[model samples]
Target: MEALLSQFSFLSSQALQDKNFDPTKIDDLMKFFELEAYNSWAAMETDLKKDVDEAEYTMKEAEDHLESVMDSAMDEFRRFEEELDRTLKDELDGLEQVANNAKKMGSSMENAATIATKKYMEAALVSATTTMKSAWKGLNFNSKKIHPS
Candidate 1:
């Protein structure tokens, strides 16, 4: 207030009037200062109100940004989860296919072994029969030579 008084020439011929100058009196220094002070106060109030309004706007913008970030984060999380699920399912399916292939291969190997064993037994039987027939022919020929019948 004193700074305002010093900056502006508060002392003048009108303010030189008596100390009991009527406040309601027009064209008086007291009335002019009173109006000036009210105007200054009103201007300060208006500036403060503008500041408050701007701060509210900034706060609302910040809240909106935070909400958007949260929504994006949730969406990203859902996508990651879905991707993980798909990878796991695909891996399980591959494993199942591998298991099935291994089972089929095992069965095929068993059948091949059985066929080889059957072939080996048949070949042994044929060899034994040929040997027996050759021995019988030799015995009959030797008996005819010894008896001369």
Candidate 2:
């Protein structure tokens, strides 16, 4: 690069050395400089593209490795989830048997309490519906006004 720049500088100095340099000759010199600049730029751009392609290939290989790791992690997670589900089912069955035994022992008070709790929850839910609707409307209005598109 330094050698090419030095050669270009020498050429420019030689071009300027002529005492009675013709305008047409000067124009030709300018065209030569322009061509050289364009060719140099094209070569640099090609080298940059090659570097970019190599970088992209390296990134793709990394992505493939990441995907393989994620697949292995997912398989381990699935096995863990299956084991957890089996344990939960066994616990649930034991709880169900305990509840049946309690019911057989005439635990009618628990059933009544459960019904009352359900009724209270339903009433609270109904009462909050209008407030929730109004809040949602206000949020939507503010969001639309603040963010156009």
Candidate 3:
């Protein structure tokens, strides 16, 4: 986060430098004009007032320009944030679909296992019944043959 702030600061400084307006040089140039030592003090005062007004206007223009650039940067950042949010939401939705599908497959497998167990139990019961019936018939036939006197 600190790195991001430092980058922003550097960008802002570079933008200001690109304007090419040095306040120290402007002050020095104004001092060279020497309006303070003019013969007519009132005219000098008016000239000074005009210079101050011009400086104020220049400062305001610079501030407005910087504000515009900052606004554009913020708009770009907001767009990136919105896109990131959309991507994350889409990925989360896909993951949820996968999880639901896995759960459905598990349920199907459990139902198949239950059905197989029921079928096996029914087949075992039928086999046991047939074996018992066959044994009883054999015993009765043996007794009849022995008593035929």
Best by lDDT: 2
* TM-scores for all predictions: 0.52, 0.48, 0.53
What are the lDDT scores of the predictions, listed in order? Answer: 0.81, 0.83, 0.79
Clashing residue pairs, candidate 3?
none
Query: How many clashes does each candidate structure show, in the order listed?
Result: 0, 0, 0
Candidate 3 residues 33-137, lDDT tens each?
444435357787899999999999999999999999999999999999999999999999999999999999999999999999999999999999999998888
lDDT of 1 by residue, 87-134 (tens): 999999999999999999999999999999999999899989999988
TM-score, cand. 1 vs. native: 0.52
Candidate 2 global CA lDDT score: 0.83
12-92: candidate 2 lDDT, tens digit per residue: 677689666556655665677688889899999999999999999999999999999999999999999999999999999
lDDT minimum window of 10 residues, candidate 2: 139-148
Report residue 98 deviation for candidate 2 (angstroms): 7.0
Q: Which of 1 and 3 is ahead in TM-score?
A: 3
- Order of all candidates by TM-score, from best down to worst? 3, 1, 2
Error of 2 at 108 (Å): 20
Worst 10 residues of 3 by lDDT: 28-37
